[model samples]
Target: MRETKEINALLHLIDDPDEEVFSTVSERIVSYGKGIIPNLENLWENTPDETTQERIELLIHSLHYRDLKTNLSDWGKLENPELLQGALLIDRYQYPEVSFNGITQELERMRRNIWLELNNYLTPLEQVNIINGILYNYYKLKGTEVAYTNPDEFFLHKVIESKKGNAISTGILYAALCQLLDINVLPVNIPRQFILGYFDPNYDVLHAGGNPAHKIQFFLDPMTGQVFTHKDVETYFKRISVPPIPTYYKPLTPKRTIQLLTEELSKCFGSQPYKQAELAQLSQLLGD
Candidate 1:
């Protein structure tokens, strides 16, 4: 591979101002991961490229092989992709992003800085309380979970088809944030719902959920951020459009939630008013 200095020399040679060096670097930087980050940063600095800077940031993120607290400056060489993926598996849970040997490693890079923000936040709380806090906060800041399906089958299908707002994408972002906080959250598939998550506590009686209705409430030990089965929804999913469905606020088992996301995702591809193939894929994931 070419060294950063050599690449730096080449980057300056792009005669056409309109030519996108960012796109060039996007594809090229993967192999170089950590090594190319400084040059990419330099590229960002020299060029009038707010957008390119973002892309380079993603490149650097995709290439990262360390935890949130670890600085790149202290790093050594990254050996292979497998090791890289193993480093970023986000604890025990696996998703479409973690599907293979070589591909898994490359995909880990795609996760970018998803878990970067989560390092120091989590504490010895029950798992469910943490779930409620995250969902509640996120919903308050960004309304409606940025849902793909609006209960209108036709419109929902169009959004999914257009690759617009999606549950999986949104869920991933949500999960990444939780992970970064050192929050051990897992995606739980709830029936008829696209996806819910869980952060298991010490006792089996201890569980929590993310409700689609109401305040995204479920259960939590407010003090420790731990989740418990018996909790309230009026406090969760605070900025939700609908009123709290107290009847809906209940403990969700991981197995049950998986089934739920799969079924709802299947509807995406089903011949409803808003049929989508993406739903089929998501459904299959849950079933698997």
Candidate 2:
């Protein structure tokens, strides 16, 4: 930002020894919004003190986080929030400067490739097979169990670039692809697992009153693109000593799915108090 006399004065006081004075100065700098970031960065470069640099870093993070919260709040209000965009917003929490266009363009390329092989005659299972083959075989995307030690796996851009993600990230990627292709795949609220369900196209319009599970043609393990049957899910419920309730089988709305992602991603920040608090706040933005 074009630094005014007041902005220059605030930048000078950022290194103040008094905690109260520094806190007040920091708040005023943040109040200027993200436009003040350039001024902070310039100060950091000329300043020799490590402590002052750290303070400037925190100021920059505060600005980015404030902006992120606003974006996520707006995203949560959408009628049918785009899954990929939601994931990208979560991604910005860690990588504020990362460009999402590359990720979008990459997804578009994959979509075009899948579209070329798709036909109107393909059955639901066949359609899923094509997606599985392209994503797993052609794209070579790998899925691992969720590991909090490796936080990067939860990020959408990192997942795309590394071709590896845990269940949540991979599931989001899968659901996003289906969205682009107009497929009826969605995430289901299976306890302790992130699974996708392939719903019958007419279920929403024709059989909306029945147990939602009855409307699902099959289930998918996002970790491997492997298919599961009703019997399989039923056996899972029995093994876990939980009843297969109607809600468990219902497709999750995009908002809920993104909120789930945010909640899961928050687990990776347990060691960083500021990050954990920030993620908790982000998740609250999507709260019911």
Scored by TM-score, the top model is 2
**lDDT per model, in order?**
0.38, 0.91
Q: Which candidate number would show the highest lDDT if scored against the true structure?
A: 2
lDDT string, candidate 1, 114-142, tens digits: 33323345553433333444444422212
User: Candidate 2: where is the Cα deviation over 4 Å?
Assistant: 205-208
TM-score of each predicted structure versus truth: 0.30, 0.97
Question: Cα deviation in Å at residue 53, candidate 2?
Answer: 1.2
Model 1 residue 280 CA deviation (Å) reads 9.7
lDDT tens digits, residue span 31-64, model 2: 9999989899999999999999999999999999
Shift of residue 267 alpha carbon in model 1, Å = 2.2
The global Cα lDDT (0 to 1) of model 1 is: 0.38
Prediction 2 TM-score vs. true: 0.97
